[model samples]
Target: MKTQNQITVTQIETIEQFESLREEWNALLFQCVEKDVFLTWEWQFAWWKNIGQWEYQLWILLFHEDEQLIGIAPLMMSQKRKFRFHFRWLENIGNPECDVSTIISIEPQKTISALLRYLQEKRQEWDGLELMEVNATTTGNQEILKTLEDSHYGFWRTKEEHFYIPLMGNTWEEYYNQLSKNMKHNLKRRMKRIAEMGTVSFKKYSGNSLTWQDFQTMCKVSEKSNFPDLYKSDNLLSFHKDLLEFMRELGWVQIEMLFIDERPIAFQYGFLFDNKYEDWRGGIDKEFETLAPGKLLMVFSLEERFKLGLRESDFLRGVYSYKTDWNPLSREFTNIQVYNTSNIKSKLAYWWVKHLKPIVESLLSKEKQKEQQNDSS
Candidate 1:
């Protein structure tokens, strides 16, 4: 056992360097209290390979207590120009892609103290740090925030909504029964309609069962979905291809497809990690619109997870209002963009963003509303 002060920090800035930490990275994640699929080495690496590499450079910080890895910062850096000012900033990997990211540590306070000290020590390297999609509900993350506050790192946060269904030992039957009468009726009706078309079945791919062909088939279905443009970009498709290939190798890919006889209509792609099912992306064939394949598959997927002994179904972050129908509990993720307190310009920018910007926006919005009212008259 190593004391907190003895914990050593190292920086990993190259892909080759990152590849070496896979086993250790995941092992440390397994020991964390707030483990999620998004924080996995594969997910972060995949996101960086496809998205971050074009602009951002890796700045991952790893903390070790003599040879045993204890915590990971999972951060990256990019030189950015905004509002006509050039500056550098660091952020957690998997931005906009992962639902949330948090500090991976067994000891939150000790790890955060070490992390903050390191950041301040190297303040010249970055003018700010934007830690995105941090799960505010977890006590560990709360501790991280508190440590930053105590350290006097001037920080403010914005929030995003996350929704999930807590299955924590509840049977599918109980969950189904708990749905509102209208929802239950709609689900049954949709299921029955799809059943009438042909034999309804479910296909799941994970571990060794996943294949690129099967994954492409799902993408084809999404291409014709109500969210047709979701996979319209070759770049986005390429990212998923790389991400899925990496995640599948680790037995983390959890894909559930709803089929009618020989035809696939709806599919859900996500990771089943640490006993939770994250519903990353799912879509239905618009050809099956009348059958409501989207809703049918959603309920089926939930039940399938129940059978798999999964604990929660995270609907994740986005504007999917339909998730409310599942009676999912909700949480908020805090996105903190902290300035480098040592830099006067950075501190001023942070204060302006935290204070004056909102008021300015509010006034602009009111003027716009007044103009709209005059135009209507």
Candidate 2:
């Protein structure tokens, strides 16, 4: 056990250095107040391997005390061009693919405060910061923003909504009854029509029992669906294949498939981690659209999750009418951007592009339209 006071920060610059910290990194994950699989070492490393562009430099921050790992800020630095200027900025490693972002540690306030002080001291190193998919409600990521603001860090933020289902009641039927009358009727109708098509069955693959053939089945279903291009990309397929394999070893991967007459029509790719089941992605066959196989599978999947006594079933990102129809709870997340005001170049760039440029462009557009109207008169 480590005494909390003697904390030291180490910057991980190379992949080998990052790899060396894996054992302690994962151990810290379970000890954190918030359990997010996105912050896991495997997910972070996999994202870097498959999707991270070559130009970005790794700057993962590791916080330790007496040889025991306490916190991590899995970050990277890159330069971006915006409105005639290029500036360097830091951000969490997982982007575009990751939904929940935060400093992975037990005492978030203490960890973030120290990290901020470190950043403030080394302010010349970067131009700004942009962290996305921060669950402002849970994770206490607001602390990061607050700490920055208190230190006069120039930043902006925007929020988006994420939804989830909280399974209630001891029985699946009881939980089913809580849905709106319209939803209940729709589910009953879909189930009946699907049943009439042929023998209907649902299967779930988890752990090492999952195979590449199962992935191919899921891709085939996605290919035949409304989103035909969803699974068409080789890179995405490879990323998912690699991620699924990685997650399986940790016993966090789960895939659900609905078959009619032994033919796969709908499939769901999800993760069951730490008693929370996340309905990550799924696809449906267009030929079975009339039978509503997708909806049927979703209902079965939710029921299955409820039977397993999971704490919550998350719909993940993107708000849709169907997600709302399920009548689940919601969480709001924000994207935070912090400018390095201490650096003259970054300060000028931030103020010019983010503040002055937008207002100037809007006024200029309005004036141009006015001139045309006056000439017509």
Candidate 3:
């Protein structure tokens, strides 16, 4: 009913504006081409409340025609300090924690062009745009990058390996049989060993089934594990606790724990969104490393995922030896840095980072290698 000229693009700058748009925002996400649990309103809002600082300015873009919300670019503006220079940059609100970051849009190309044009109008406010953790295999994201190039946006990309398991077959047993012989035997042997040691219990908590106490237990296990000490920070703990509560309300969260005689050894925190089970974060107490509790937990979780008929299980970021053991298909995630070529400072910084930094890194690497060689001699 609305013409192209009737469509309006508005910038949401305050949390109040963001909250009021939640229903419509989620509705827009439901129809988006790229669907992930991280893109939800709950996740975005929670991230802003917990991880996001007051210094960062919110720059969420919303597009609507005939009062019907169509697209959203969930972004924020922040200052990046490098070598005594503070450069303003635009980035997605949830990063480092949220994987597969992307805009929520059915028409990605059109929406991206409009958002970019809007950004250009306010070019003075930011020196660059760093779109990180983009799933490289996604056609929509590829088109967005191409559009940026066609529009003469000065940008460069770096990639890292991302992995996921594509579920197949009518039953879990069928899928299990497809694994390599060594993996199959090892898993069975380890599980059997665990059973012999003590009563092994694998419990999965979903939705209302999970409680704050259960979450705390998982956190305790993570504290004892070899994973990065994210829980040690009160801010991160608060963020996750809040995030878990929000996701639980949506029936989107799942927590898996491996218990040996009621003592938790390993824990996996994940989400079920759009029929896919995504592995968010996990930890295994190294004290039980010889028992291979982490691997046992994963095996139990995979079997549960199969029973649930989930489409796939994404291990998210990082390429670990255990992930390779699962034989997951990989999708590369790219970090895109777009500079405002019109700005002198932005141009200089981009050149230094894109050109000079790599050369310096290579030289340093060679020197380190030589040092090691000389030490051995």
Candidate 4:
């Protein structure tokens, strides 16, 4: 273990170093009380194995206090062509399958300060650090951003609405009562109707007993039901397969399958890590839409998660109205993009796009409206 006085930041270049740092890194992250699956080694390593080759470089920043690991920042370096010079950027390595990205550790305040200091000193070697898709609502992230601001790093925010349903020690009756009257009525009606169809049941499976066929079936239902475009991409399919395999190996995969008369009608793919169950994906058999299998699946999944002793169940990133029936506390995530101040041309281009794109889109929308009106006349 290295003390703060003798702290060293080394680029993680070999698989051995990455594996060796895993225990310490995870220890620090869990100590912070963060509950996202993206921070898990199962998720990150699967991402690295599947997609890290696409990036220019990958680096893991480790901080130690008296020879004990205190914090870590898993980053990937990439180069993008700018107007003058090629700009290098460091970001939380992410892919389509992942939901959120940010620096993860227990002591974010201290770790972020050190990270900013290192980046400022090495500014000559690169353009700037770009922390993308951070959950701005998280207290630790707000502190990290404050540290960056104090260090003279320019940052901007783009808002994102994440959907979730909270479950802690509340009974199902209490949860349902909190919903709006109309929503409550609708949900109760849906569940009752589904129950009338046949024996409706929900089962959650994790651990090594789960089979690959179960995973493939869930993927197939997802593609056949909501957003076929997601599975259309070869990269996304490969990433999903690798992630499932990795999670299964680590016993982090939490699957909820809703059945009517023992026939699977809906399923949810969630990851149980860091004491939280993140609902990563869901699919329903359109044939069973009238039975409201989707809602049944979610309700059952929530109960199942609670039974497993999980703290929170996140619906991840969509704001569909149906999710509100569970009465979750809404939170906003943000996207932060930073550019090098030294590159004036790149700055100008970025400003133009940022400030002018909305106006251009609005004008085009009006023009289309006028054309539609003229054709009607």
- Candidate order by lDDT, decreasing, is 1, 3, 2, 4
Model 3 residue 227 lDDT score: 66
Supply candidate 4's per-residue lDDT for 75.
77
Query: Residue-wise lDDT of candidate 4 within 1-377, one digit each (tens)?
Result: 22245555555765567656656666666676554678777677767766675665776777765566666778777776755667777777674446877777667776776776666556665565666557887788888777776655445567777776666777666766777897657667988888888988877778776776777767667766867565666666676677777678677887788887877888888777767787877888888777567877776776666666676777777778667667788778876665555556446645654687679999999999999999999
> Can you give the TM-score per candidate against the true fold?
0.91, 0.88, 0.93, 0.83
Pick out the ten consecutive residues of candidate 2 with the lowest summed lDDT.
Answer: 1-10
Best candidate, lDDT: 1
lDDT of 3 at 158: 85
lDDT against the true structure, per candidate, is 0.84, 0.81, 0.83, 0.71
- At residue 117, candidate 3 shows an lDDT of 75
In the range 171-275, model 1's lDDT, one tens digit per residue, is: 999999999999888888888877878999988888878988888889889888878778767667777888778877778887789899988999999888878
Q: Candidate 2, residue 57: CA error in Å?
A: 1.8
lDDT (Cα, tens digit) per residue for candidate 2, span 80-180: 87656777879989777787787887767777777877787677788888888878776456666677657677777777888988775546788778889
Q: 103, model 3: CA deviation in Å?
A: 1.8
Question: Candidate 1, overall lDDT?
Answer: 0.84
The residue pairs that clash in candidate 2, if any, are none
How big is the positional error of residue 127 in model 3, measured in Å on the Cα after superposition? 0.8
lDDT of 3 by residue, 1-377 (tens): 12245656898888888878778878888876677888998888888877775657998988776576767888998988876889898898887677878877877776787777777778888888887788877788788777876776677888888898887554777777878999888888888888887899999998998888898889889878886486877777787788777888788988999999989999999899999998988889888888788889988899888888888999988889988888788988888888888788888887988899899999999999999999999
